[model samples]
Target: MRSIIAFFLFIFLIHSVQAAPLLQATISRESQVIGNDGVTHTSVFQERMYRDQNNVWLERVLPKHHQHSTDAKNKTSHKHLDLSETAQHYFLDNKKSTRLNLVLPEDKTVIHLQTVDIEMLGLTNCWTCVFSIFDSQSVKKMKITQQGNGYTWYESQNAKNKIKIKWAKLQPDQNPHPTSEYYATMDSIWKIHLERICRLWGLNLVKE
Candidate 1:
C-alpha cells in the first residue's frame, strides 16, 4: 500500500508541473520622436505576453481600423514589417534548443526560423526583453538608469535618430492561453549566445 501511494503521488506531481498555467503580462511601449520641424510626436502601444514552462507567446495588438495592402508590387521585402497582425511564439526544450515562428494573421503566413543566433540578432533569453525589439548590441550601447520605482529606463541616440524605453514591473495576468503554433524557431546556438550576451550586459535572463 505504501509503494502504491508513493507511485500515485509521483504521477500527480508530474502532471501538476506539465499542466501549470501560463504567466501573462501586458507590455506597454511609448515612442517619442522630434520631427524636422522640431515638433515632438509621441505614440504608445501595448502588447500581450504569455509564458509557459518551455514556451513564450507575444501578441501585438493592432488597431481595429488598421488596413493591409494586398498589392504584390507595392509589398516591401522586409520580413519584419511585412506582417499585418504580428505574433511570435518561441519554443525551448530541455536541451536549450530554441525555435521561433513568426505568425502573420493578415497574410496567412508563418515564418519559421529553424536556427537563430540571439546575440547576432540582439535578442536575449528573457522573453520580456523582446518588447524592446532592439538587438542586444544596440541595448549595450543604450544608457540604463533605475527609475524611482521598480521601473528601468533606457535611451539611445545617434546623429539623426533617438530611442527611449521604460520598463515596468510585470504584473500577474488573469488569462493566458497555451503555447500557440505561430512564432520563430531557434537552436541551441541561440541559447548559448543569448545567455552570454545578457550576462555581459548585466541583464537578467528568465530561467525555467
Candidate 2:
C-alpha cells in the first residue's frame, strides 16, 4: 500500500509540472534585404519574452533602418543599430481589444497588440505563443527541415524571394522555448518602410 501511494504521488508531481511550464528567453537576430538593384540593407533585431503562471512580457526592437510601427512595449539591454530607434508593445489580458500608443523617446508609435495576432507573425510568436509556431498555417506552408535538434523554415513557393527562419538553444523539456531565433526576408524589399513586431506579443515597457 505504501509503495502504491508513493508511485501515485510521483506521477502526480510529474503531471503537475507538465501541465504548465515557465518560459523566459531573449532571442537576437540579424537580417538583410537584398534589393533588385543589387543593394543589400542589413538590420539587427532582438526579442525578449517571459511567461509564467499569471504574468507575461514580450518586446521586440528592429534596426534603426528598418524602423516601422505597430504596437508593443518593454525594456531590455539593447544595442544601437543606428539613429532610427523604433519599437512597440502588447498586453495579453489587458481587457481592451485594440489600442495604439506613441512613444516620444523612440520617436515612433507603438501599437497595442492582441495575443490573437500570433497567427500573423509566424515564428515571431516564439515570443508569446510558445506552441503556435508548430500550428501556424503560414508556417505550415513553408518547408521545415530539421537541423540537428533545431528546425529551419524557408519559403518553398517563390524562388527569387526568400525568408529564413531558425531557432536555437531550446530548453531540455517542460514547455521548451528557444533562447535565440533568426528570421529574414527579402520579398517586400521595396514596399515596406519599416518592419515591426507589434503583433508578435502584447507588451508594455517596463519604463519610459
Candidate 3:
C-alpha cells in the first residue's frame, strides 16, 4: 500500500506540472518618459520572467492543425500572430497583466533598440524562439521564426526599432526531442535574466 501511494503521488505531481499554463513575464509599472527631444512620452513596461513547467508548453495554444499540417497544407492556419486580433487573443489568454493599455506613448522619438537572444525550449520543429520586450510595454511579444544561425532580430522590421527594449533567446535542438527538459531550462534562464533587467531599470519585479 505504501509503494502504491507513493507511485500515485509522483504521477499526480508530474501531471500537475504538465498541466500548468506556459510561464512568462508580466509588465508592472508605468511613468512619464521624456525623450532628448523634449517630448513627453509614456514609459510602459512590466517585469518579465519565465513560467514553470506547466506554462512552458503554452506553445500548444497554437492551433493543432497548424502544428500537424505541412507548410502548404495549412498555409492559412500558420497565420497566427500576423493579425492584431490573433496577437490580442494570445495576450489575453496568457493571464499576465500589463503596465499600460491601448494608450500610445506620448512622444514619438526614436529610442535605441537593444536585443538579447536566448535559447528556446520545447520546440522540436524550430531551432529558436526570439523573445522580445518593448520599452513602451511590459508584454514580451515572441515570434517563433525558422531555426538557423542566420536569423537576426535587430534587422527584422516586425521587431521594430525604438520601442524594443530587450531580447532573450531560448535554444533547444535535439532529434527525437526532449521538450519538457528544454522548456524548463529556458524558463529558468529567462526568469533569472528578467530579474536582472528589472533591477537595472529600478523596477520592483513582484511588488508592481
lDDT of 2: 0.37
Candidate 1 lDDT (Cα, whole model)?
Answer: 0.45
- lDDT tens readout by residue for model 1, 89-167: 6766556555565555544455554444434444455543442333445545768754656555666555544455444
- Evaluate all candidate structures by whole-model CA lDDT and list the values in order: 0.45, 0.37, 0.24
**Model 2 misplaced regions, further than 4 Å:** 1-22, 53-56, 60-89, 94-144, 147-173, 176-208
Which model scores highest in lDDT? 1
Better of 2 and 3 by lDDT: 2
Cand. 3 TM to true fold: 0.22
Q: Give the clash count for model 1.
A: 13
Q: Which is the leading candidate under TM-score? A: 1
Candidate 2: Cα lDDT at 135: 28
